[model samples]
Target: MNQPETNPDAPLPRPSTFPDGLRVQVQGFDDQQAADGLGEQLTALFVQMGRYFDIQRLDGVTIAIDYEEALRSLDRGCATRELAPSRGRTVGVAMTPSVLRDGVLKSHVFVDAAVFFGMLKEDRYERAMQLLAHECAHVEVNAHYDRCFPDTLLRTKYMNAQQGARSEVILASWDEYAACALSAKRGENPEADYRETFLNDLADARERGNECIKAYRLHSQVGQIVREIREIYGGLMKHAAYYLGNAAGFGKSWRDDPAVAEALTEHWFLPFFERLETALAALYAELGVWPNHDGFEVIGDIGEDLMCEGGMYFYDSPDHPGEVGVQLPLTPDTVPY
Candidate 1:
């Protein structure tokens, strides 16, 4: 949908200066050597991101692989504490095989351990770096959002499973989009990076030898889905709005009826979806890109029907099939990198 172009020349907003104690821990692996190696690598990565995002004052971030402890921390309501106002911090990293195969769903980050091991096995350090960078970007985005609009975006919980799913899809799109943009500039291979990280490792060698074959295939399939969603649908901002809006409308309808308050509370995406569009626009502008019709178009193809389908549709559709509407203005008058 079309929105007024965000001024490309606008000054970028800086990340938070608050001292949120960010930490990362690894779990499910028994090999001390592997755990230590992963921990060191993750620590360096966080340090780099902290400096880049200007969160130095934030308590040092941690990376651990203690699946049991991580689960315990999460089960005993660790997220409640982690998300507490006074102790606003995030914990996550490249997940181990066991965690991915059989861990309770948490809001925590999950990196495919097999994929990670595959990258390491293949000696694709550059690809591994890209994966690490992508996960780290999520942390940066989450922290930035928390600091900038804690009440509006961070506090509202998704009202239903549908809304939650929609929010997640959009969030994942943006995460990958940002990661792709950053990785491209840094000379990283997105496909190889994802493939090696998600598909190449075995989660259960004894139960299912060569099991990763199917998992690897599935990874490739999902990777393609994400790419198609970005290329065909449009940018993350537009797609996210489409799903989030529907979810929000659904939640509001239920909330208006007191009988469904419990159900609504359990299933809304409002918490994360609320203000997501604005936040994305701000981020796009900060990155020096215009948040105009053309920018959204390049992110994906939003036709008249899909545009109208969402309440926020703003861009004009093409006159005919297989055509672009208009090119949005970008900063520096140069092509998008």
Candidate 2:
């Protein structure tokens, strides 16, 4: 295994180890009491997670809770760093990109306190723990995955922004499914909620697409070189991927429900949803098996399948030379003012 690069200039946080060998590093808290309180709770929560999963693998891992620092670090790594925070959000992150601290390759679990504490303020403790468990499961799965297969997809450099964005969505879909499946054994099963969320997103995307079409027909106006329809459709695709993956992770019985089946079919995303769910289950089942496989490659293939089967195709934009345009699964009719 290649050793993680050392950054000597990085500031070190004071990490505390609990009785179970779980180490947590808390930062960006003004009140020491609050910091200690959160640390103790996190340690306890990790211990609880150990009951179902082999969390012992995370012994040397450092769980970092820093809102501001996490935001800065994640933004630095993102392509849309110049864009406002409302464009995207990061609540937690995990795994094999270990940091070298004091000559030791230490894996990490990062949770943004801004999000976690906000959930707690709303008395959403179960949801917060579910998020934490999902991150921790990412650490566990990533470690095991590294030992098995070489992740060729994410590690490779993409040629363009669109390619990079597509890869990001695929990778995120696979990661969320694996982590959510593993964590849901001990956490909450949110399949019903996820199903509703996806349907709602589909409705909103279609509405936005309608407005974009109306604007283009009347004034020959669009959001940018890329049409607003494509942007909203792309976002809708990602939302479907994430929610369907999460729903499948907990349980797939929802798929058989009359309402969900009808809604998915009507929205024209059922094919993609089915393909993704099938691929996710296959990849997850192959984990820890004898022969190693590149699960990321499988996901990439699934993405191709979805694009072909779900009516998502790309063409050169007629209005903007050298620009790629997407054809969505559902066509939006122009709406009147």
Which has the greatest TM-score? 2
Looking at model 2, the pairs that clash are none
Model 2 TM-score is 0.64
Instruction: Name the weakest run of 10 consecutive residues (lDDT summed) in model 2.
Output: 75-84
* lDDT (C-alpha) at residue 60 in model 2: 40
Q: How many clashing residue pairs appear in each of the predictions shown?
A: 29, 0
Error of 1 at 253 (Å): 40
Off by over 4 Å in 1: 1-24, 54-109, 158-170, 191-283, 287-337
What Cα-based lDDT does every candidate model obtain?
Answer: 0.37, 0.54
- Give a tens-digit lDDT track for model 2, residues 6-91: 38797533232223655465667788787777676667666655555544445343334544445445322213332112233222
lDDT of 1 by residue, 1-337 (tens): 0112348797535544323444444445788676766666665455555444434323233233343344334332212322211111112334211111122211244454555556668877566665655554444544443444434233357543223334444444444444344434222444433322222211111112123223434564533332233222233233344332222323323234343334226332233223454454444455423333244332222222222222112233456543223222222122111
TM-score of each model, paired residue for residue: 0.40, 0.64
Cα-based RMSD of candidate 2: 9.7
